[model samples]
Target chain A: MEVSARNALKGNVKALVIGAVNAEVTVEVAPGIEIVAVITKSSAERLGLAEGKEVYAVVKASDVMIATD
Target chain B: MEVSARNALKGNVKALVIGAVNAEVTVEVAPGIEIVAVITKSSAERLGLAEGKEVYAVVKASDVMIATD
Candidate 1:
């Protein structure tokens, strides 16, 4: 599917932590660079996500934030 | 403020496109890598965003989506 999000990091599912409503997924794009995403458990189940599975962590531009140090 | 999002890319603002309600911000994290974000105009105004300003492009874990290719 085509998405408008500007960032798509190809990675492997490093870990999955499921809760009652949300599931925390860890995607390691590089050796030590990991992007964590919290998605709905239903979505997680729909995606059939598992450890070592190849997936893309999609982030929408509108949801991004700009901060100063 | 401390954010729980795992991805915090340090970059400089490359451009700003402001609308009536929202503003599009482009941040260059690396030499050729840029991350774009659309934020509320109020927030942009509050942050005093301008071109060449150093800022961080932040993404919340919950806002991230997982997709399979």
Candidate 2:
């Protein structure tokens, strides 16, 4: 699929915490570095996300805030 | 800063393409793995995001969709 978002991190499904309306998915793109995504519960079920499953955390935001200290 | 979003990728500013109101920021978290974020021009300037500058790409989305094929 062709996505406009430039960031595409390839990783495995480390963990999935499903809630009533949302699900928190943790994708470990590298060692000790993980990307957590909050997706809909239905999308999680539809995608069949589970531990060790391979998936990409697609982030398409019009407002990506930058932080520096 | 305490953010609700779980995904926080640490990387250096690889590139920045500024537009009139929005700017595309490229953050290279790992080798061959980069994250692209679209942020406001003012925010970009406030954060002082530029090449070689280290920053964190904060993505807080209520709808993070999952895809599999």
lDDT of 1 by residue, B35-57 (tens): 79999999999999999999999
| CAPRI quality level assigned to candidate 1 from its DockQ score | medium
lDDT of each model, Cα atoms only? 0.90, 0.79
Error of 2 at B4 (Å): 2.3
Q: When only chain A is evaluated, what TM-score does every model earn?
A: 0.90, 0.89
Q: Candidate 2: misplaced stretches above 4 Å?
A: A61-63, B61-63
Score chain B of candidate 1 by TM-score. Answer: 0.88
Which pairs of residues collide in model 1?
none
Q: In model 2 chain A, which range of ten residues has the least summed lDDT?
A: A57-66
lDDT of 2 by residue, A1-69 (tens): 778765566789988998999888888878988878888898888888899998987777564566776
Best by lDDT: 1
Residue-wise C-alpha lDDT for candidate 1, range A4-60, written one tens digit per residue: 788887889999999999999999876666778999999999999999999998888
CAPRI accuracy category, model 2: medium
Scored against the true structure, residue A63 in model 1 reaches a CA lDDT of 83
